[model samples]
Target chain A: MTNVSAELDSRFRAAAAEEGLLDVAYDVVDSPLGELFVGISDRGLCVISYEADPDAQVERLARGFGSRVLRSTRPVDPARRQLDEYFEGKRKRFDLDVDLRLARDFGRTVLEELGRVPFGEVTTYGELAARAGKPRAARAVGTIMNRNPVPIVLPCHRVVGANGSLVGYAGGLERKHQLLRLEGALLA
Target chain B: MEPVRIPPFETFYEEHKDPVFAHLRRLLGQGAEDAFQETFLRALRAYPELRNGRHLRAWVFTIATRVAIDETRRRRPMASPWLHELAVEDGLPPHAELGHLTDNLPPKERAAVVLRYGFDLPYDEIAAALGSSEDAARQATSSGVRRLRERSKRS
Candidate 1:
């Protein structure tokens, strides 16, 4: 094994990396925006990504699972199953246990508020923060989203800037634009 | 005043159901379905004392953990079938790998590690739940992590 792999493996095991393996046993899928990274955990469905950077993905996984990831043969896996239904517009509510471990206080509050944004609709950061009972925390909410533990799963793309300005997204503005278009939120 | 009976047991079950079920599911894995039913059965027997909702979730977890441990001990010397399934699903070799990490650790250490990983609990909460000093809880997690790394390295 490569030295980096060995080091990564050892660090992961030291994190007591069980339980999450089942959750991370997932497969990527082709989406309108780009390749999607969806993984599950024993607690429930976890990360749904749109980026291609392995390091960022690994760091997110490690924060939740220490370093454990699993693969499954069934292409129609739990994570994929629910997510496919979500994008197909068949499922509105998610039945997954989200791991918001990397989020805290304001970040956590922001994500929780995002969950209430409702499907097939969009909301601005200031509106979301107001719902979180901290209207001035809008900018803080935007910063919180820069490191959202579960991006697409938490629907960070659904958040727009004031007056519907397509704001910055860790997964790139293109994917954000595509997602907004897919949800029919982008204006003519 | 004679202790007044609460409404139907369903009320308590309805209140604490999901969190209790989720807790047991993490603790015992797939075996939680059965253990959950057993927990409520035992709870029914002691319904009067379960009135306090302040720690209801933790209380349910404690009882469920005890029951799971008992069932686990009762079936010792034989690989736990449920654990075997979990190991296989997690991509670990079956047979000897089922409890390779867990069976070797002490119960407190195992519970501490399980709670920490399963629920993402911090050291202090784990110590409180396991009735140990914060230092002891941290030690248990540290040692447990070390042993897991060592065993996985050999594999």
Candidate 2:
């Protein structure tokens, strides 16, 4: 689905925050996968890490967003609700604004191609590599997916081994299988 | 001067809520909650202008003072005509202890005491917030403290 939300209008921002001039705000949200650390930049959702270490993630966010980050749920509630809906099989698409500044050059290009891989479908790393305009950079595509800042929402789990088998997943293969099974992409 | 980076509104709230809330609570008596909320809303609207990031705590308290005064102005006229609008205040009792301590002071003097002693705001900042000379701010606080002591001795 198309990304949703433009500028958070003054009215919404005013109610959502006290200062309303933060560089970024983040909070830990409950997911089917456990607690997910979500960060929303002033622009949009910028970081969603599979890594659950909030301190490290906060450090990284400070480095990226310059320590203007605080834990506020208002900006992140929409993203969290959509994720909940997805895991419950009620949503096939994420209609949320995403800021991809962290992903860059080859990695960013790879994620854009990964978005086209679609829901309830699977594709090969080598295939996605070619789609990213690198005929032989299958391993590089793997690296890109591995480092994906925004994972499940971006459908990184949809990429598999060339043998058409589920391969590595940052969230672990079990979660990957769980997602694929939920999506009905895998058959028992 | 190099621009000081401002944190997210959430973070700022976490760091500053206690002092700001306490300051507003003492000033507005029954309307403290409304004043507290409005102060932050006004601060949110003015955030971009504070990107320079000098004395943010004092700046916020300054905003809270303005909000408290504005709340007083709002409540004065509607006190009798619209009693139902005052229902929320009925639910949450004004902090009777602190309210009694400074209840006799005028709004400006109450603000001066709350800012100076309650929040430890400096004269210059308090004056800026009250739109008066620093000496006037000090006088207000002195007058406020003197009245509070007289009320305490008589009781």
Candidate 3:
């Protein structure tokens, strides 16, 4: 039997993309914080998970987006490059488009505000809630931060406790501290 | 019994793609590439709703067979008789020897024979793939085999 051709594989992917069936294309990239599972949709970059289990991450993406998630580097290459630059301190702001479909309502609003916090700056959850037009929803904002899908790109680590203590990062406090220090937001 | 966990679509695709392609190649020959893509596309579209991954191989083969049937039906009206005659005179293409033998069979019979003999799938699985009774699947396979035997004898 003849081996399956590489040409056919790419053609299928193109056809799937054209039909909007290739909902998410993902790849893993090495970082100072270990491997980052980066996922992108045609809409934009959607998921940057710090989860250890790759299978669970893919399953979550399949459930959130459609099940047409494929392991291809092409769609995620730009985000990976930007992340590499950010880690190396060569870039401050992300130029790539982000897909925040995974976060909805107030959570989405909070993340949108978080994106504007800039490099090396920190905001309290209460302040972020006010920025999102809900001064009394600070604890709710904390819940949103704990569930932030696109973490580092949206800079969820920059949100600290009310007393300026490092707190409440889904990727863990150590990684958050490292991220803040990397951005010169925290004095090491 | 434990419930079967459906794997991620990527894992499912990697496991079944080559076998499904080989099955389509035996039935559709050069047209297998298109059918292969169609099979996976359909599979991916419906993958999340699948509650059971126990028969995923058979499930994909069913999609491949239906795609092959559609492709053959689409091509029959446009295919020239002389083109087929010339192909016969020139001998069958290397990757398509089985395809040539089964080309004249009814689509379901061709699929039945291929699934039964080539892939060693049971009559029940073949029935499921062909959407027929298991007895009918067995008859289709035997009749397809007999027809191929007579054709080879005459040649």
lDDT (Cα atoms) of all candidates against the true structure: 0.62, 0.72, 0.80
Q: Backbone collision count in every prediction?
A: 2, 3, 0
Using TM-score as the yardstick, the better of models 1 and 2 is 2
Q: Chain B of candidate 3 versus the native chain B: what TM-score?
A: 0.56
Q: What are the RMSDs of all candidates, in order?
A: 18.5, 11.0, 6.6
- Please write out the lDDT profile of model 1 over residues B41-142, one tens digit for every residue: 566546545444455545556666667665554556355444544344344454444344676777777776555654456777677566667999889976
* Ranking of candidates on lDDT, top first: 3, 2, 1
- Clash total of candidate 2: 3
- Score candidate 2 by TM-score against the native: 0.64
> Which of the CAPRI classes, incorrect, acceptable, medium or high, describes model 2?
incorrect
True interface contacts retained by model 1: 0.00
For residue A178, give model 3's deviation from the true position in Å.
1.4
Alpha-carbon TM-score of each model against the true structure: 0.46, 0.64, 0.72
Candidate 3 on B1-155: residue-level lDDT in tens?
Answer: 66687777777887777878877877678878889999999987887678877878878888888787677657764442223432343343323355566788987788887666554567876886766789999999888777766676687
Question: DockQ for each candidate?
Answer: 0.02, 0.13, 0.43
lDDT of 1 at A101: 62
Q: Flag the better candidate by lDDT, 1 or 2.
A: 2
Scored by TM against the true chain B, the candidates give 0.48, 0.52, 0.56
lDDT, candidate 2, at A68: 53
Model 2 scores a C-alpha lDDT of: 0.72
Candidate 1: the clashing residue pairs are: A23-A40, A23-A41
